[model samples]
Target: MNIGFDGKRAANNLTGLGNYSRSLIAQLAGFFPQNRYFVYTPKIKNHPQINRFLSIPNILTELPNVPGLFWRTSGIKKQLLKDNIDLFHGLSHEIPLGIHKSGIPSVVTIHDLIFLKFPQYFGRIDRFIYNLKFRYACKNSNRIVAISEQTKNDIIEHFNIDPEKIEVIYQSCDDSFKIASTDQLKESVRLKYQLPEKYILNVGTIETRKNLLTLVKALKQINEDHVLVVVGRKTKYADLVNQEIDKLNLRPRIIFLQDIPFNELPSIYQMAAVFVYPSVYEGFGIPVIEALYAHVPVVAATGSCLEEAGGKYSSYVSPFDHNGFAKAINHILDHPKVQKEMIEKGKDYVQRFNTEIISKEMMGLYTDVLKLHRSQHSNDAQLSTRPQRSRRSQRTSKN
Candidate 1:
């Protein structure tokens, strides 16, 4: 079987869906050596890493340089038909309409429906197009892969998709995130980023959905010597977030490291006094899993999918309750015994979400879909070969 993945967005983005695409595909290639893969990417000058994936006998097909219309490149269908791809997977929500028109079996991974859930968060044109693309993907795909049970429920409730067609495959943390030699790695990362020795860590895009304002407010109320270290790429809300920090007069205690390499993240997680992720909405919070894998005591948001990822191990807090969040942080900081227990529980909790298990489950879904499709085609072919006799004669013969 030949598999095709959308590697265009993945080659560029360092966050969220991109990381998920890269990691999941890499693990699939490693685990399923028998299947062939073709990764379709956009035409770019200096994408060198695409060549590295060739070690798995994969081919890279580049899209043309069409402005605002590159995603609809019908050339991908020509390539897929030429390459005889048995299955094509959209790692993101965007699926080329040509693929659906060509009657190909395509599966799309719907990370989340945040834009649909909160239309006010997005602008007019974006919200309009997002709903359009989301509805098309939900209605046309052969199967939908939801990263969490929460996301699957959202799909069923929001879009009227058949539950049988959706599979819940939880996302896993990066394989490199594990219990590290804290003294050495921590000091190295801390010095490199000029990080405080005793600090609470928060790693996510600083957006309204992340509930950064509540965290900033909570920081002002906490009476510890600990600083709040935020690590993520700068987004549109960076200025607004800074204003919120200034308003709280907690600028000195808030450290924002906007530019950091992915390799340094695990060590940073290890160095944290405790990791807090108070996101208001998520498909599956990957950072919570990362913190757990790093054996860091985590305080995650209560109602979101992070609860599923954190299980009974993490301290839960509301996204809007600044006082409650501060109290939880103080409780963890004060009790060394409770912190140690949480750390141990975190390690045990993350073991159930290993990449190997996730990869295997995904492969099983692929195999099952392939078999079902194959059997249907076989039955159709047999029916086509049979002679068409008169119904009355057939009924008489049966009598």
Candidate 2:
């Protein structure tokens, strides 16, 4: 089977959607080498992580023959036909316009509807464009792959799509997170980052939706000596969090890190005393899974899909409850047995989202969709070629 993917995020984005795109494509190419895979992007940039996928024998990357907005919207259909693609998958929440008219079965992965859910967080123009593109993709695509059940429900409620058409497939973290790092490697990472001896790690962009200020407030209540290490690009929301930190006099206790190399993140995850994700909402929390895969105890917020990502062993508390988060952190720190149990359970639970398992499920779905498409095409051809009665014969039969 020939498979094509919208590789914009895979080539450009460094986190979240990019990770999902690169991992999914790599796993499919590595595990099922017989199928030919093509990645179509508007342009290619110098991305080291994305570049590695090009080494796979079955995978090929293509740029738009005709550049600009035309390629992004309607010109892609011509390329898909030129390449003889059997199916096209949109790694992000959009597919090219007129793909359905071109008769190419398409699947789209809707990461989240956050722009729609929280209009205040986005600009009016951005929200309008997102709504238009997302609604069109959801309505026209042959299948939808929701990263979590929460996202799937949101799609149904907002777009009125059929539940059967959406599949809840979880995302996995990088393999580096799952592998146990040696003591030397951990020590090197610690020295490189100047990490505190004991720290609570939070990984994500600093935005209003992440609810980082609540975590900062909770830090004042905890009696432990652990620092809070935040690793991500800061937005305007960081200024608000910083003001709270200043008011509470917790500046010395919080560490903010940005632009950490991708290779060193696993070691940093392993060295943390505990991993905390206080986000108020998420499509699927990859950091929680990363913490679990790193053999660290996870404490995530309760109102969204964090529980699903963290699994049964991890603790969940309200995003607004500072006291609850502080208590959960102390409990994990104070009890060695509790930490051991969480690590064991989390390691086992994360296997469900492993690369091998997810790739196989995706391959099965693609095969089924392609088969159905071929069968429909054959039936349409037969009908078009069937004999028709003459006008006189039709009149006699009518009499």
Candidate 3:
């Protein structure tokens, strides 16, 4: 089978969707060597347009210069047809409009329905366009892959998609995230960034969705003598977060380690006394799994999918409850027994997201969709090819 992937997000630098796309694509190539996989991305600066998988003979990468042109009018459909793609998987949830018109089975991974769940968090035009495309994808997609059970439920409740149409394929973390010695990279990162020795880490973009302001406020409330280190790119909310920290006089305690190397991330996670993620929303909390694999204690928000991700392993607090967040942190800091228990449970929990399992389930989904499509097509062809009764046989047939 020939499979086409919409890999627009593969160009993004160290974001959640980018991580998901790269990891899933690499594993898909590894698991399904018999099938040909083609990844398509619009040309942009620094997009890794090369296929580095020398071992995977069937995987290929194609980058077309489609950034400035309108996607709908770019003759993309004609190109896809020329490739003879049997299945098209829109990993980014933006399937080219009218893809199903080509009579190819298309599946989309709707990682989350957050834009609909939290409309106030998005800009007006973005909200409008996202909802429109999302609805189209939901209606036209043959199989909708949700990253979590919570996300599947959200799709059903908000978009009213049939439950049978949705598949819950949990996201997996990279193998590099496990506990490792950071002694070499630690000095380099600390010296370059002027980072302190001990800190609580939070990894994600500095956005309103991350709820970092609440974490900052709770940081002030905690009496523990530890720095709060955040690893992510700069964003609009970083300025507001800085202002909030200034007002709270936490300049000495809060540090932003921007754009740390991915190789050294496990080292950072290993060194953390704890990793606190107070995100207001997440489709599948990847950081939680990474921290779990690294044996770091986790404190997260109770209001969203982290509950499902964290399971019994991590401490949770309502996103709005500053005091509760502080207390939870203190509880972990004060109790070694609780920390040990959490570490064990977290390790056990993350086993569910092993890369091999995720890849195998995805392959199963693709096979199932392909079989279903062929069965439907065969039935339709048989119905159309049925012989019509002759006009002269009307009297004989009646007799």
Candidate 4:
């Protein structure tokens, strides 16, 4: 089978969506090399990661023959047919407007409906556009892949889509996060970044919904010397968090890092005393999984799908409960036995999200969708060709 994927994020983004797109495509290609994979993008970026991926024998990347603002919407329609794609998966939340008419089954992955769930974080125009595109994709795609059950439920409630149409497929982290780094590598990374000897780690975009201030508040409650290491791009909300840090006199204890190279992130996770994700919500927290795979104990907030990522072994607390977070952090820090158990259990649990497992499940979804589509297509063709007779002819035959 020839599989096509929407490769916008895989080409451009360096964050969560990019990581998911790159990882999923690589896994699928690696596990099922018998299937040819085509990654379609409106444009391309020169990144070593993308170059390495394209070097695969069975994987090819394509761009529009004619460039335009609306190329991704419909321009790729002709190319998809020219390439004879059996199926297309939109790695992000959208597919071309009328892919079904092209006779190719399509699936779209909806990461989250955060814009709808928390409208305050989005502008009116952005929200309107997101609602329009997301609803259209959910309605038109042959199937939907939600990164988490929380996202799946949100899609159903907001888009009024059939539950059966949506599949909850957890995303695996970049392969780098899962590999074990030696102590020398960890020490090198520590020296390069001037990291604190003992620090609690948090990794995600510092945004309002992520609730970074909660981490700051939680840190103020702990009497230990362990600083907080926040490694993500900061938004305007960072200013408010900085104010909170100053108000609490915890600025000296906070470390904000951005633009860390991808190769070094695993060591950062490994060197931390504990990993904390205080986000109020997520589609599925990849950082939590990254930490788990790194053999670090995780403490993330409640009120969303984080528990699913952290698994039952990790600790959780209310996003607003500074005391709860502080106590949880201290418990793990002071108790080597508890840390060992959580780390061991988390490592075991994360195996469910290993590359081979997720890739196989995705291929299974693709095969099932293809078989069903062909079966239905065959039925439709038979109905269209069935002989028709007038009422008089039918009466004469009956007589």
Candidate 5:
């Protein structure tokens, strides 16, 4: 199979969709080496991280012969045909226009409908454009891959897509997260990041939807000495969160980290006393899985797909419930037995998202779509080749 992907995110964005794109391609190449893979990007940067993917034997990187916008809109179809792509997968929410007309089966992965779900967070014009592209992609693609069941249900509810047309495939954390960090490694990371001896960790973009202010409020209720360490890119929301911290006089207890090297993340997760995710919504909470993989007990907000990501063993509280969040955090910290049980269960549940398992499931979907496409083409060919007969002869034969 000559498989191609819209590698814009994989080549540019370093987190979320980029991680998903890079991991998917790498896993497929590692496990299914027989198939050739093509990654289409408008431009390639000098980043060493993304450049390493080019070394894979059966993998090739393709660039546009024309301008970048032209490539993304319509020129990509020509490249797909030129490369003899058997299948195209849009790693993000969209596929190129006219891809279906080019006689290629395509799959689009819709991460979430956050803009539609929370309209106030996005601009009207941006939401309108996003709605147009997403709806068109969902309607045109041969199949849809939702990162979580919650996302899959959202697609069905928001768009008039068939439930059977969508498949739920969970994403996994980096392989480094699965490995246990050594005591020495943890200590080094602790010193490097100036991490406290015990702290509650939250990892994600510092945005309004992440609900960091609520988490900060929860800290005021807790009587323990656990500091709050936030790790992610800071947006304008950070200023609001900071003001809230100042208003509560909790500045001494809160720490914000950004631009930390990727390799040190596992140690940070392993070293944390507890991992708290208080987001109001998510496509799929990858950090919950990452914390679980590190054997760290998780306490996440209730609502949306977080329950699915955190699993049943992990504790959950309402996103807006400051007392609930505080109580859950204290309970996990105080009870050694409960923490042990949560960690054990989390370890087992996270195996379902191992690269081997997820890769196999994705490969199966690709195979099914390819088989269906071939069968339909064969039927069309047979019908076209059949000799035509007069209307009366056809009616007599039928009678």
Candidate 6:
């Protein structure tokens, strides 16, 4: 089977979507090398993640014939047909327009409906365009993959897609987070970042929806002397967060670590006493999983798919409840027994998202989609070939 993937994220993005695309593609090749996989990206970024993706066996990367805004949206359909793509998978929220018209079965992974769910954070024009493409893909694709049950529910409610048409597949972080950092590695990373000796960690974009201010407020409530370490790129939201931090007189207790190399992330995770994620909403909270794999006790926000990612042992609190978050973090920090339980149980829970299991599930979905397409085609052929009674015979019989 020749499988084609929309690889724009895999080739360019270094964050959430990029990691998902690269990890899934690499795992599929590892498990199912008998099939050929082609990655199509409009532009490629020279990054280590892309290099790792390119290194995978039984995979080929292609670029668009000519550059245009709609290359991935509509122009790629003709190229997919030319490649004899048996199936196409959109790694992000959409697939090429009219792909079904080219006689190619397709699957699209809708990671979230965040723009629709939280419209205030997005521009009107951007929201309109996103809604158009997402609705189309949900209706046209042979199957839809949602990263979590929450996201799957969102798709059905927002797009009115059949519940059975959407499949909820869990996503995992990079396997690197699972490895324990050596004493030497930990020392190097700590010194390099000038990280706090003891801190509560939060990793994600410092954006409004991420709710970093709440975490800072929680920090002020904590009785312990530990500081807070934030690791992510800052958007304009950082300015508001900074203002709040200053107003609360918590600047001395906060450390913002920027542009830290990806290779050192696991060590940073290992050094933290506890991980706190206070995002108000998420399709799936991946940083929570990374913390779990790092064997750190987690206290994350409620009202989203985080529980699914963090599992039963990780503590949960309302995103707005700074006091509640503080209590949860302090509990993990103060109680060694509780921390042990969370660490051990979290390790067991996150195994459900390991690469081998995800690879098998992904391939199973592809096979099921092709089977459904072939079954429908067979029925259509039967209808087209079925003999019909002549008009004269019908009239004579009626008389």
Off by over 4 Å in 1: 44-73, 98-103, 179-183, 390-399
lDDT of candidate 1 over 292-365, digit per residue (tens): 99888999788768889998978999889989899998899999999999999888888878888999998888
TM-score against truth, every candidate: 0.92, 0.97, 0.92, 0.98, 0.97, 0.97
The local distance difference test score of each candidate is 0.81, 0.90, 0.82, 0.91, 0.91, 0.91
Off by over 4 Å in 3: 44-57, 65-68, 72-74, 390-396
C-alpha lDDT of residue 7 in model 5? 91
What is candidate 4's lDDT per residue for 239-315, written digit by digit as tens?
99999999999978988899998989999999888999988889999999999999999999998899999999999
Which 10-residue span in candidate 5 carries the lowest summed lDDT? 45-54
Q: What is the alpha-carbon lDDT for the whole of candidate 4?
A: 0.91
Cα error of candidate 3 at position 150, Å: 1.7
> Per-candidate RMSD vs. true structure?
2.6, 1.3, 2.4, 1.1, 1.5, 1.4
TM-score of 2: 0.97
Candidate 4 weakest ten by summed lDDT: 45-54
Tens digits of per-residue lDDT, candidate 6, 338-375, equal 98999999999999989889899999999999998889
Task: For each of the candidates, give the backbone clash count.
Answer: 0, 0, 0, 0, 0, 0
* Number of the candidate with higher lDDT, 1 or 4: 4
Error of 6 at 135 (Å): 0.5
Candidate 4 lDDT at 212 equals: 84
The positional error of residue 212 in candidate 6, measured at the CA in angstroms, is: 0.5
TM-score of 3: 0.92
**lDDT at position 270, candidate 5:** 91
